[model samples]
Target: MCRNFVILLFFHICGCKELFDFRDKNKGSNCDVVFLSDSVKNGTITSPLYPSPYPARTICRYEFQGRGKERVQTIFQEFNLYHPRDDNRECDNQDTLIAFVQIEGRMEKIDTFCGSTLPRPVMSNGPRLKLEFHAVYGSRYSRGFKATFSFIQNFGIKVGVQLPDYPCAFVFNSNETRSGHFYSPNYPGFYPRDTECYYFFHGNQGEKIHLHFNYFDVEGVFPCEAKSASDYVEFSNFVSQDRKYERHCGQLGEFDIESDRRFFRVTFKSNDRLDGTGFNATYQFLDKVESFTTRSELTNETAVLKDIDGFITILFFLMIKLIR
Candidate 1:
């Protein structure tokens, strides 16, 4: 029954080919304020008056475009947007950082964040991404944000973007990379908020998977327990009910989990409030126990046991008749 559930869920949310059909979209129209473009495979962007207080009543917009069907991924190296109300600390209230994706001609707002914590990495659904910063009237207590962006190249039919090496930040999915060496969006650097990355690992038949983390850090400083509202990494198996998942946060250095079947899955989720530098991990296939017998041999053994039981029953009946 558990196996059936996994198979059902797997087919329910998958399709690789035709990942993006860049439609009749107005090219880079999401920037409503002062429009700017920095076309680079790897680069950085900072708020208007970064390191100093950002200007009041200002809106700055930027766009990162990848070649053809390629997509953009970004990391928030430093974030210190002003809070209009320190007590309430609303990101949309004063200075804010927002990310948008233009997919099939429609612009969708992907994330919005403010305050001190570095959020998780952000990945675009398509080839282009729009980034905006809005600062309201005052910059009294503010230090602007700094962000980095990179273009991700597509390799083959699976249709997912390839993740760069770690110690940096970005939203990363590992379904297509079966090699099992995947990292949190920005490793060594702090991750972003309102982020969720999924990884699916598959092993050879008759083999299991070994997964371990080299480093992990996430936000749990503010309590929002009812919704499991902490920045954490969750694990599960997609091929079986070996659902012993591991969730880690806040400077956990070394942790590991194993898979019961050929398929393993992992997820990293963060809240909009606070976060830390994310995690890094590796996975490898391991051979199963060698004392196993094939199905035909096992069936033959069962048949032999049944035959012996029948012979004993007949002998008992004969003895009873003789006694009578």
Candidate 2:
């Protein structure tokens, strides 16, 4: 009986260890940076990228926006990387790794669209990354009117490694707005939609970094009562040097608005030569005016005139009319 009890205790300890190990692996890390609506009034940063000690092959996950019963479709129209290294093989396959749905444009002629990242080369076998999506509805609606959606952005790495210290990462910043004709048949009119971008870096304590930007507006129509716009920007970073991976997602949002024309900006400066960066800006305009014209006036600049001698002719026509 004594031997059996001892054996049972040994097994119990082993089981507890296994449980703890699994829990640790799945546990979410405390976000080093988080930017959401209603938080920042306005601001900017010099260098958006932060440092991380994890191998260059770490994978990160980010979730941006969701939909409810209202039947509004959220679309990611464009994705761009700035100063990206041509040597980065991962970026070369952006079309395959980053997925998006084009609502109304050159790509397709659909009212609604949805897509996901396709299969790609894995860079590392380290900690897997997942993204969860959430959405909030307006108060004017009834029960079940407001809802939140959740999804995971998974990152797979081929090569694995044991880190001596947690890795550091950087968050990109952006600002955008949606204003134009509401293509929705449910609600029609001109409403304004705006968004701000920010980022969080989570890894080793010393490796984390945070960057933020203010909100901006676009001249177009947006859904009504859609307060606080938010979404996640997901991507895979492949380290070709060591054949590793670093997937990342930095939560970003815009909450406070104190002006009429909303505009936001992001800046980055780095001494490290390896630090790569760039940005993409897009603007869509609808033609509503019937007549448009422009003229240039001469100030302190020299003016040149040409004289032409020809049969000068002036014609004027007048007709006599009696008041009726």
Candidate 3:
């Protein structure tokens, strides 16, 4: 019994030693940098010494790759990096987190982030996304940042019609569905600066496209100052070069519109400067004859119901008089 107790105590001591050592490593020195795998549906990226003041002169790179039509999205849950002392709301490169997105084989979309305000969620336009975190030597090291990333599927049909050479352009046709919804790029979040996106809608013959915007908050003035450099949304019924379009901007909460023909187009343009949470809209293809015919029938039925009510009221009064 004495020998057995000695063996059990030795094993317990060894186990406790290993556990404490592992935790010590995780406390500060363990820079939790995890690379994404094809099988990984979601994961996290954190700075070295995360939750603790990160060490200076450290750099971490995270790459995300998705398959087929899947895209990458990331939301920063905790962000506290050192920025310039002037508090201008822009990072001076002392410590920063930068994102590079590859869209349509183009790397034109690059964003830089720093400071303590949590960043808006980011969605890559394509399957490839790269992130770099930098902490300059001898710079202030804060608690660092933690972000969660996942692979998500994009919306809209991608067949038949020719895709635009630019990013954020989509085509929708009635053949796929009679009704659908679309949102501004990075919607519910402030859109990127100096960006333009196009949405094309096609309907079958005898059908008109009806678009209803549930939310609209593009940054600009009402009627949109011509060439004054502000964000605005345009609606067009024609696809030709000289086709006329109506432009609107400012905080118009909700509105509805209908196309004069079977095709329609929407263009969202944003310039460098103030930005706003974009818009969300739904569209449907309505048969002109069926829609108007139903309305006409409903109107006639309402008139008949009114006449019947008046006749019943008159008959009730006459019966009361006879009883009296």
Best by lDDT: 3
Worst 10 residues of 2 by lDDT: 14-23
Candidate number with the higher TM-score (1 or 3): 3
Question: What is each predicted model's overall lDDT from 0 to 1?
Answer: 0.59, 0.19, 0.69
- Candidate 2 Cα lDDT to native: 0.19
Ordered from best to worst lDDT, the candidate numbers read 3, 1, 2
Clashes of each: 11, 34, 0
What TM-scores do the predictions have?
0.47, 0.18, 0.55
Cα lDDT of model 2 by residue, 1-324, tens digit? 332221111222211111111112122121111212123211221101121111111122221221211111222222122212445554342111122222222122112111122122111111111122111110111111111221111111011121223222222212122221111011121111111222121222122111122222222123211232222122111111111212121222332111111122121111111111112222222122212221222321223221111212111112222322
Candidate 1: residue 60 lDDT (0-100): 63
Report residue 201 deviation for candidate 3 (angstroms): 0.5
lDDT of 3 by residue, 148-211 (tens): 8877653222332435464556888999988888887667656655566778898998889888
Query: Model 1, range 254-280, lDDT digits (tens) per residue?
Result: 766777777676776776555566777
Best by TM-score: 3
- Which lDDT value does model 2 have at 136? 17
Better of 1 and 3 by lDDT: 3
Error of 2 at 308 (Å): 5.1
Q: Which residue runs of candidate 1 sit more than 4 Å off their true CA positions?
A: 1-39, 87-90, 154-207, 211-282, 290-324
